[model samples]
Target: MNVRFEKLYEETKAAVMRYVSAHCYSITDIDDLFQDTYLAVYKSMQSLTEPIQSSEAYVIGVAKKVLARHYSAVRRLRAQIDVSLDRRSGRGLAEETADSVDVEKLAGDRELLDEIFELVTVMPVTVQRAFYMHYVLEMSFAEVGNELDLSEAAVRQRVARALTEIRRLYKRREQL
Candidate 1:
């Protein structure tokens, strides 16, 4: 590894481990996320044009993407499991199931939370990083701005835009 990447790893490895551990339920999952996060950083490190103001924040951003992709794949796998179980039981419970047994009930409002995450994922990378740092990780806007090389006001705007998009997505999904 180059000196810069080595320095980044040494500086941010603990924070990355903590991030993965906090976000995942299992040790295996944490390991997987950690590996994936480092891989992402390694691949993208070359493309970073400017000096990194906050290596911790940048690595955390990569970790968040790894987690999101992991969760999305897990959700798909769970849906497949549900389908397989229903088929194996050889009983059609679809019609008799209560209307309340949708994604909301299964996840206790987590469906909406996942929707917000999905919306955030589609945002520009910088904006997504700012929003995640400020909201999900509870970093101050000033901290996020410093990390992302943006003004605090710019971070605030990114967060506001992300929120607006999430609200719009929620409303549109509700209508459907």
Candidate 2:
């Protein structure tokens, strides 16, 4: 360590530590942030062009940058985690619409289930297979395509067409 940096550290370490401690919530985070602050200060000290007039303020500025970076990274990671969870939970547009209907409430109605099956059975064989593979078996479009030797787009088209037809049939039955 440079003699100048050692002197600067001795002078401003306490203030930097207090700043980091007050901003950070966890002890581990505090320790990490404190280390990062000092490491940044050390690097800045190495590239000295002019003598820093106020070591305390300079150290505090470094700590603030470290804190900002830490918070930004945490926010980015949380957003990525939320996106992963939504994908895993099957919360895409079609799935969200399906979820709006209370399937559990209708589960005991055998006649309704039969009518749904009849509507599904009316779909073309490929459409029926696509719908079953994608929704019933929880397979992705790519997986369904691989299994049936169809393109993913073709599989998606089949499933979407089936859903639209089924929704129409369901509404007609409800009108009756």
Candidate 3:
């Protein structure tokens, strides 16, 4: 191990472990996150150009990225499962249309998609991510949970809130 990295690990390991533990959903995830955090931090430290005020904070930021990437992969896996199940069940586009508004029309309208994009941009970041994951990425609420590290219910609520806001905005715009 590099001397500086060894020193950093000695200084920050306990606090980092606490953070990873608090954020992790599983014991396996805890180990993976911790190791990935240090590896990222080590690479970052090697290439660092400017000074960071806190080593622990920087390492924690890298940990956050690792967690995000991990969750992204999980979401992809969930989406794949969702797709396979849909295929096996013979659920087609019309079936999906019955559950929600047909995004197909909006998807075909570049102008409408652009307008909705702008509307979503102003919403809270959490809602935006959930909305994008569920609608744009074509993930179910359960898969959206993987992206946000939230419960399926929680991601559903976020997307619902975004939809409510978009409906309100569209109604108001129509009266103009």
Candidate 4:
């Protein structure tokens, strides 16, 4: 809309897209992350201080935070699903103990393996959507906000909260 915003968009869009792509795996995910990043930038443009010379740096910082949050939430949900599956399988106590240990080990491996999609589906609708846009789709925070009608900061916060929940889930799994 404004000249400054337009200029900012043109100058940083590719960098932002690359940033998102580095964190994601798919073309669709890349597009989503790119959009989210820009949408976040758009919403926060008004609050930025003057002489903000490094737009790319700031946007990348935001993108990192967003990616961390998304991954965290997905990890948490995965932990929960693993736990639930463990319970439903109704293995004996000794078997359960062995299974639990195996599951914890599995979780660690899953994290390394980047089996995120399996866990991403368990989040709440809004969270999942945001998660998909930012992580799976690789949309930037701003892009996520624009598609979902939220602020970039709000998207960042959502992803962060999701990560927190996920960490809690993993900790619980490890303890069990």
TM-score of each: 0.43, 0.42, 0.42, 0.40
Stretches of model 4 off by over 4 angstroms after superposition: 74-176
lDDT by residue for model 1 over 1-176, one digit each (tens)? 48889999999997897566556533335568889999999889888888889999999999998888887966647634222232224223222323233445334567667655555555566776676566656788897777767899998987886665555544444445
Cα misplacement distance, residue 4 of candidate 1 (Å): 23
lDDT of 2 by residue, 1-176 (tens): 58888898899876676566445533235568878898999998888799899989999999999989876876547634222232223213232224245556567868767756655555555665666556655678997787667899998988886676555434443444
Model 2: residue 111 alpha-carbon error in angstroms:
60
Instruction: Count clashing residue pairs in model 4.
Output: 24
lDDT of 4 by residue, 15-117 (tens): 6765665455333345656676777777788787665579789888777766665557775465343324533232222222222234446565665334334
Candidate scoring better on lDDT of 3 and 4: 3
Per-residue accuracy of model 3 over 23-141 as CA lDDT, tens digit each:
65443356788899998888888887786578788778888888788779766476342212322232121222223444454456665555566666555556766665556446778
The model with the greater lDDT, 1 or 2, is 1
Better of 1 and 4 by lDDT: 1
Candidate 2 lDDT (Cα, 0 to 1): 0.66
The 0-to-1 C-alpha lDDT of every candidate, in the order given, reads 0.68, 0.66, 0.64, 0.61
For lDDT, the strongest prediction is: 1
